[model samples]
Structure formats: C-alpha cells, structure tokens
Target: MHKTLEGVQQSATPAIRGPLQVYLVVLALGLTVTAPSRLAQVIAAAVFLGLAIDAVGVRPLRWLAVPVFFLIPGLAIILVTTPGHGLIEFGPLTITQGGVKTVLDTLTRSGASIIVLGFLIASTPVSTVIATLRRAGLPSVLVELLLYVYRAIGTVFVEAERMQTAAKARVGYSNRRAKIRTTKLIASTLFLRTIDRVTHLDEAMRARGYAGKAPATAEAESHGYGLSIGILAVLLGVRIL
Candidate 1:
C-alpha cells in the first residue's frame, strides 16, 4: 500500500482501538443504511470524511474519485430504466421521478459506505485489520483468505511495476498504438502470472503443514472507547430525529 494511503500508523494520543474501530464501522454502516433521508446519510458521510482527512490529510481522498466515477454509470442505468412520471426525455431514454429518487438514495448509501470503509483503510494497515477481525472471532477461514488476498495484491502490484519498467526500457509504449498493445499484453501476462503465483503460494502453505486456521496474532491494547461511543451516539441521534 502507498504511504499516503496508510493512515496515521501510530498516534501519540490513543485513538480508537482495533475492536472499537471495527464496531464503530459496523454501527456507522448500519445507521447509514437505515438513515431516513439523504440529509442523515450526508451527515454520516461528512463525519467520516472529516475523520479520514484529519487522519491522513487530503491526498488519500483522491481515491474516493474512483468509486464515485463508477457510480455514475449505475446511476445512469437507474435513471433510464426505472418507471415513473417522466422528468426528462432524451430520444428513447426517459428519466423518471422515481428514478431520480432512487439515484439519490443509492448515491447517499454508497457514498457513506465507501467513505466509512476508506477511513478504515487509511487509518490502519490491512494486516492489522485482518488481525483485529481474527481476534474478534471472525471465521478463521475468512480471516486467512483475507490475509492471503492482501498479500497477493501486494505481490501483483510489485510484479506489475517490474513488468512496466521492463516494458518501458524496451520502448513498449513509444507510440499510441504501442501503448495499447503493451497494455493488452501486460494485462494478459499479469493474469497468467497471478494464477501461477497463487498456485505456488498454496503449495508453499501446504508444505508448511498448513492447517485450517492461521496463527492468531497477539492482542495489542487500544483505546478510544469514549470517542467511538460518542460518534455512535451522535449518529443514532441524527437517525432518531
């Protein structure tokens, strides 16, 4: 993971502990989905966005753009396909009142969830999150799977960087045509290599007498129960009123 994406790894003041952080995320998500109106959802997202920025600065927020952009197509689909009083028309496509409402609801729900999860990743390394989940009695199989997937993503990223560097040295992207061809080749090769890598990893784990469960990590004491409680309370208040 990039350093900028890694949130405050360590803080002088005790922040939300691992378990508490997980609980807060769950609670926030629950509140977000059940939020009665867009205003409530927006407030929840705003709070999380503030915390994320305060933890890691604004640079990491740029990643938020990726998810938001993806949501655009989904929103467009909902706008055209949903049936209701016609609000606008473009040739065969018609935007309906129901569709607009659905889009706003979807946007708020997705935006809130994404921002909350983004804050989690920014504040803690994924390994720590996996460990926290394992300790929280998340199924061992699921925890192990998450750990391996995280490792695999890192491995793939490094491999892709090496491949790109090698390609650049060979002038693989010297022209527009070359760039497209190089990208296509790299993607296909990367997929094949990833499969091979996963196979080797599985073999290695078996060689080590891999059991159904991975070893549990030592518990690290964390604080911030009060802060978590406060945040959850505020969200509940907003939902109720």
Candidate 2:
C-alpha cells in the first residue's frame, strides 16, 4: 500500500499541484485585467507566490500535459461560445470584435495560468498535495476517491501493456482480417480482465474494513492555517478588485 501510494505520489506530482500555482498566477492576471491601478502590487504578489513555490521545491513544466488537455480546450470553448458584435461573418459563423478580444484575453490568461500550475506539480510531491488538501478541509471521501482513481488507472495501463506484449510474441504478422480478429480478441480479454480486477479490489477493500468512507487523520486536519488564509485572501482580493 505504501509503495503504491508513493508511486502515485510521483505520477500525480505534475498534474495535481500544478493547479495551485496556476491559480495563484491567475489571481495576478485577474487583477491586471480588472484593476490596472493595482497592477504593480498584483505583480509583486504573483512574484512572491512564484518564489514561495520555488522555495517549497516545485519544478517547472512538469504538468505541461494538463494544460494541453484542459486549458487549451477550455479556451477554445470560451472562444466558440463568446457572443460578438458582427465583425467577421462567413455563412453561419459570425465573430464580433468584442468576442475576438474576449477570446484572446481568455486564452492568454489561461495559458499563463496553466504554465504556472505545471511548474508547481512538477516540483511538489503527491503526499504533500494530499496533506495540503486535508489542511484546506477537503473531505476524506474525496481524497480517497482521488487516490483510488489514480491507482486504478495505473493498474489498467499495466494490464493493457502486458496483454499487448503477450499478443505480439505469440501472434506473428498476420493479414488484415487476422489482425482485426486479434485486436478484437485482445480488447475482449482486456475488458474481462479489468472487470475481474475491479471485483477483486472491491472484495479486498471490504475484507480490510473499508466502509465507503475514508478516515481522516489528525495530521491532515492540522495543516498551516495561516498560509491557507493568506492564499484565500489573495484569491478573494483578486475577485473583488
């Protein structure tokens, strides 16, 4: 269990903690967009946040994949949905100047935010993230779900890799029809295997006294309140100003 948690901690390092850094950066960007008068102060705050993450050992560009998967798509959605004054029209597609500007600003801000987050995740450990969440008053159920989902995905990937390797070793190059048949067989096998593993895991959890709820530890409840409060204050100030 410990090894599994450790491995998950490593894998989630870039994706999980990166968001926190991104949020901090976004706070600055928000102030810049909404309260240009406070731009200098906001920039200073952002710099301090960046430095703090560095002091805590966050790595840069560790969670780049997350931005690619999440931020870009979200920006695209904003661009597509934003209403515009008729500036460019083609058939049914009309883009207003205001919409274009909105899209551009959203994309730029989101991109920068994602980069900041990616850096943090690359540097912070998974265990520390869980600890942080616990400190922030996150429910144990959510944390346990996060951990289980991470582990389950890893297990599925390992199983799939093993199946692919076995198939390649036993079934030499075949015609298109044969290949399709082999692919289907592999897919079917994988599905069945995954179901079996889930069943076993469910049974094991039950045997080990898992009652649909994760127990919170005292350590998780004892996170640095002052730091959390400071971060929240920054976030709120950005929203208000």
Candidate 3:
C-alpha cells in the first residue's frame, strides 16, 4: 500500500514541482488583451509561447482539450452577439465589417486564453491542481469530484485504446464491423465501470464519516482568498488597459 502511494506521488510530481510556467503564461495572457490594435500579434505571441512551453516535454498537449472545447464556442457566441455596422445584407442575413472584426478579435483573444490554460494543465499535476483548488476555498466535495473526473477520463481512454488495439489485431484497418463492435464495447464498458465506481466511492465516503457539508480548512481558505484577489487584479488591469 505504501509503495503504491509513493508511486502515485511520483507520477504526480511533474504537475506539482515545475517552475511557475503556467502562472507566467497566465500573466502574459492578461497583458495581451491590453495590446490595442496589435491584439492579433499579441495572441499569436502567446500561442507560440504556450506551444514552446509544452514542447519542453513536461506536459502533454492532449490535456488542453478541456479549455479549447469551452473557449472556441464561447468566442463564437460573443462574435455573433456583438453589435456592428452591417457590411453585407441578404434579407435577414447580414454580415457587418465590424461584426467580422469583433469575431476575429474574440476568436484571437479566447484562443490565446485557452492556449495559456493548456500550458498550465500540461505543466501542473492533477493532484496539485486539486490541492490548489481546495486551498483556494472550493468545497471538498467539489475537489474530490475534480479528482474523480480526472481519473475517470484516464480510465475511459485506457478502455478506448484497448478496444482499438483488439479491433486492429482482428481486422487489420479494413474491418468496419470490427471497428463498430469495438467502439460499442468500449462505450458500454465505460458506462458500466463508471457507474460501479461512483457507487463504490459514495459508499466508501459514507463509511468514512462523510456528511452533507464539506469541512473547511484554514490554509485552504487563505490560499483561495489570495488567489482570488490576484486573479481579480489581473483581470481588472486587463480591462482597464
């Protein structure tokens, strides 16, 4: 048990002990929004910086999917809603030069933000992030959920890879029937496994004296407050500039 715990700790170290590269990237992101008409240049710079940071091989790029998934669609919505002078009119369908510009700007800015966040996830460990969030005053239940979700994603991927490999071994790349069967197997397995895990986790938590309320730790509260203030200051400065 102790050895297993140590192994887990070692596996989690890359995320916890790295230089504050994520923080620096975030600071740069905050500065980019203030770059006036050079916004596109700033966004491009941030993206390159983030990629370079990831290229150091400390963090995997796949971890960035979460932020990109959320940011791209959000920017699209912002661009669609922004008011502008209509440049193209086709009955009710109008495309304004200003709207186009707004969309471009939003896309650039949001993409830059997601890149910075991706860099952070790549550099930081899931354990450290959970610790940070807990320390930052998030409820313990939420922190635990975050950790479980992280682990669950890894579980799902492993299941997927196994199914794919099995399919490939049986049907070479041409077996569409094998591919579909393998995919269904992976999906059904994940769903069942997830349900079982959630049930077991809930039971274990209850057995361990969990109640409806999450206990607050003083250290976590202080860290959360400090981080909240720092983030707010950075955002305010970005808007002001």
Best by TM-score: 1
Tens digits of per-residue lDDT, candidate 2, 1-241, equal 3223234335432321333533443454454445433333444446444544544334322223322433455665555566866776767766777767776665544454444433333344445445555655669888667546544544454455566568778772366776667656665676567667866887887899978654433222222345545755765565566
Best-to-worst order by lDDT is 1, 3, 2
| Residue-pair clash count for candidate 3 | 4
Would you list the clashing residue pairs of candidate 3? 15-124, 15-125, 135-220, 136-224
Question: Which parts of model 3 have CA positions greater than 4 angstroms off?
Answer: 1-19, 25-81, 132-241
Worst 10 residues of 2 by lDDT: 58-67
> Which rank order by TM-score, best down to worst?
1, 3, 2
Angstrom error at residue 14, model 1? 8.2
| lDDT (10s digit) by residue, model 3, range 94-197 | 66777778777766666665555544444444545555566557787877875676555444434444545676887744667765566555555655665576
- List candidate 1 segments past 4 Å from native: 1-14, 141-219
Candidate 3 lDDT (Cα, 0 to 1): 0.50
List TM-scores for all candidates, in order: 0.69, 0.42, 0.45
Clashing pairs in 2: 18-117, 58-123, 59-123
Candidate 1 lowest-lDDT run of ten: 5-14
